[model samples]
Target: MINTIVIDTEDMDVKPSAVILSIGGFAFDVTNTSETQTAILQVARDPELALYSAQAFYGLVDTFEQLMMGRSVSSETQQWWRAQGEEAHEALVGERQNLATQLLHLSGWISQHREARIFFRGTDFDGSILEHAYRMCGVECPWRYNGKRDVRTYIDAMTRGIRGYVKDHQPCFAMTKHCALHDAMNDAEQMTLAHQINSEMLAA
Candidate 1:
């Protein structure tokens, strides 16, 4: 329907704002680097687009409880945790500090780009996780309430409520399914293409 109708008004400005982010979930695994992609340096180099993945660290008690809760995890992973002993606790503490540093860096970026819009594929999931991470780190989320944007909602608006169409059409690339960086990049690319198409429609 978006393709069929051309609304005559001010041209829709689809040039994506400054940055796109995909925060990883609450779960933390020291062995899994896929969930943590700290892009502070990248953000410094390119102000046009920024992507980051935030990870949370839980205490050993919580970790074991989580292990017990996650029955589907492989035996090897369980054994790995068991073998960690005091080293695992130390690692988690280090990770928590790293998370705090990352969040502070993010806050600085957001402060610098005061008007930038933060886009997320699933805001409720990613956004909440990021916010919680901030709280856990004792840092305030820097972006404003209205600055939080959702990719699905944007796509639906741009495509006349077309559902699941964009998911299948990821631009020429292989996404490492659960990898935070890959997922964020994929979503950002989809939003960019959708914005381009929507802009063309408005011009037409």
Candidate 2:
């Protein structure tokens, strides 16, 4: 049984060191050697409520080529890639390096604080996507693996796994689904609600 660790996030003068991340990508297919395409990655830093994010998209040219060969991708996705044209891949040259550097830097900073945590909605999905990206870049994930936290797990535990409970009470910071940046920001907001719920339950 997992226990929920709640804190008084609202009244605290000094915020804890943490970050929330979200990734928008193709369906997670472990069997696929290509490891699915990661469309975007977003990060929301806590304490200062700062957003230190880097956005990157890869394989647009390859996707476009595939579509030319009559790939059966969704019309929306195919149109989006077609709109980017063949030069889409070259336009974002070195973006992967930039993304990896930013991730490495954030991981390094978080690792400096023993209690710092990295929060994501799903550890298996989001965390694995991040790990795969880092591996592709030949960069080691600097933060301790134990520091990785699951927002969904914490929130579910706080709400006793009641569906829609968190959604009803949580702040409406997320406006768009399937968007990494928006989802990451929303997760940070949801964490505050989780803390409040846990605190109230404890008080009662």
Candidate 3:
């Protein structure tokens, strides 16, 4: 009965600290991992947004419209993602959702699924981008303070047991597609797995 929201976010740039370029998220139960709901919101781009390097654009943004419309570009992060591999680029842009609409939609979704706790892989980075996005949209965030859960910390504590179980039992997480949607869904799935494994270990 535990509903968990797994989320991932991509940044627009590095130096000034980038704004959120895109977001992928999904909700699933820790006990019933098979049933999941997902959301992807790619921010609309600024018309004057300049590329750090022409090649950097190759991976991150799918179109001019999908780019973060109000925020400026990040040269350092652009060069960094350029070096990261093919799939990494897809994270910046996917299905387009205006930042304002995306914020409203997420707020509504969270409200509907009030029992679901938000879980992000990178607490600091993801939290910052999302909070900034809300501020940019002039919207109050949906969740109460401390509503976000730390997947990294929970997973870190279960690392040794999870590693042994995976090695011996061959449990696998969904692929890290580098797409925001897929990554977020993966986090949801992994959260369920983590809860399952930890409970089993403790019971044993």
Candidate 4:
């Protein structure tokens, strides 16, 4: 069971900050804050599970990037990008299976070890970029074009009944007017902003 669901976005955009993926007793928190700044958080009975999640998540991003770029990924290419992608997919599975596996493990761990629920919060770009990348990579999300499982529900929950905020917040940062929307921020900085916004929300 998912105990916590935290969505992060800029005050000006509706992009998702993070998507929390939990497994038997672990959580792999995936975030797309920047081109190179991706994150995976693992929480399980065994600490080693975190390593597996990290490797798998990184492999997924790498494979997805290659597919999105449309580089000649065939084995005939001197770079063998296609073969490398195939190898990356194998590595991702060898490291971790589908999203469900990670969630189930986290649920089990919470039940047996009394671990706290996992939550993710970040900028709106997180969701938008992720959805775009997923689509580009041919991965199907059980959500709408905006990447929210339910658009109306997502708006109400994220905006807290602030109609104007809900109305203006876009699914991707690129669509927003904020100058920082597309400005590259390192992973640590992005994480800091995410935490800052989450804290502000809690304080309110």
- Largest TM-score belongs to which candidate? 3
Local accuracy of candidate 3 as per-residue lDDT tens digits, 172-197: 33343555655655555556666667
Using all chains and alpha carbons, the TM-scores for the candidates as numbered come to 0.51, 0.49, 0.69, 0.28
Q: Of the candidates numbered 1 and 3, which has the greater lDDT value?
A: 3
Q: After superposing candidate 1, which stretches have Cα over 4 Å from the reference?
A: 1-97, 164-168
Instruction: State in Å the error of residue 160, model 2.
Output: 2.0
For residue 90, what is the lDDT in candidate 4? 33
Q: lDDT of candidate 3 vs native?
A: 0.55
Worst 10 residues of 4 by lDDT: 175-184
Writing each residue's lDDT as its tens digit, candidate 4 over 1-204 gives: 222222222211133222221111122222222321222222212334343442221211223333335422333433432334443323234343333343333233334323223222232344454444355445553235532332223334544553312333323222111111121112222333344444568888
Model 2 residue 107 CA deviation in Å: 3.3
lDDT of 4 at 156: 43
To one decimal, what is the Cα RMSD in angstroms of model 4 from the true structure? Answer: 13.5
lDDT of 1 by residue, 1-204 (tens): 001100000001111210112222121221222222233223223422422323221211122322233312345544654555563223233222244565565565444434345666655545655565566546887755665667677777765556723645743344344334344444544554566567778889
Model 2: runs farther than 4 Å from truth? 1-99, 108-114, 164-167, 170-174
TM-score of 2: 0.49
Candidate 4 regions with alpha-carbon error over 4 angstroms? 6-47, 51-60, 63-120, 145-204
RMSD of each: 14.6, 14.4, 9.1, 13.5
